[model samples]
Target: MVFGYFSNKRREKMLQQLSDSRPNLTRAEYVNRLVKKGFNKHQAEIVHDVIREFIQMDNFSIYPEDDIHKIYAVEDLDDVELIDVICKKLNLREVVQEDIDELDKTLKIFNAEYILTLTNHISV
Candidate 1:
């Protein structure tokens, strides 16, 4: 897996160990806790990024940034915008619910309002 989120070898090792120990934790759960424990968003992203690659069988290039707003506003990250950043960095098009409980849990962690705003432009 691409532990690209951690630049520090020590932190990456810690994250890898945790991943090994907790194979059942949802991605958002692990990621949210990691952020709470001082892992920045970029670091959390690495975990999701690699996992997305692992699960993405269709090679979809456009992944939305939040559970609600599939329509991510691109704030000019060079040639590619926010959605493009999500695609290039994470290769995701959706933040799946997996289950109702999991969906609610992630929504709380990520903030439902922000997710709604970001995903507002997206379609089914």
Candidate 2:
């Protein structure tokens, strides 16, 4: 069966890896940590919700420092969909290469916090 954009085997492997590496935190604690890191509550929530929906994972399991590349394969159709969903959810302008370059990092190294920061500056 298909799971999100992943095949069943790929999805299961991803979920298993995530479960093994997941941080020990409640949802409230996770969000609070994001806010403590300078992300506003709404931004944190959006990141949490979007990631949870995107990967079909427990949102609290995701950490700001978790590398997006490690979470899933990059430059795939799913990657594009993730960016689109985040932009739409945050009402942000379309993401461009300049914006990614402004972060001084490539998509290969992006994490949840980087996403929040990127979108924060891009919001309409």
Candidate 3:
């Protein structure tokens, strides 16, 4: 009887885990999400492919400096970090962070756009 009870509990736990898992999304759906966030269809598609490939890489990590926690979604990435990395990778304009009011405002604007651009609705 005890064994049976434990087995039933294990089964229930497994079922719960399965139900809690998020469903996988189609590529089109992911692209649509990016488009809605202000990216043109072409840009969205390109970004989608980039993100997909990045996630699939064996050693792909948003936060390479930190091994304990890695970013898998847009939310996991900070705007400053995202913009900094992207700028460096693409040779874009450099961004500076300041604690003053003007700098804070500039960072806010960049964050608003960068967050939407880097983040897809799907979990990596």
Best by lDDT: 2
Give the alpha carbon lDDT tens digit for every residue of 4-46 in model 1.
4443455445445544554454566646755665544663566
Give the winner by TM-score.
2
lDDT of each: 0.40, 0.71, 0.42
What candidate 3 gets wrong by more than 4 Å, as runs, is 1-20, 57-70, 73-124
Better of 1 and 3 by lDDT: 3
Enumerate residue pairs that collide in model 3: none
Give the higher-lDDT candidate: 1 or 2: 2
Clashes of 1: 9
Please report the TM-score between candidate 3 and the true structure: 0.37
> Candidate 2: which pairs clash?
none
Model 2 CA deviation exceeding 4 Å by range: 1-18, 21-23, 58-60, 74-77, 105-108
Of the two candidates 1 and 3, the one with more favorable TM-score, higher being better, is 3
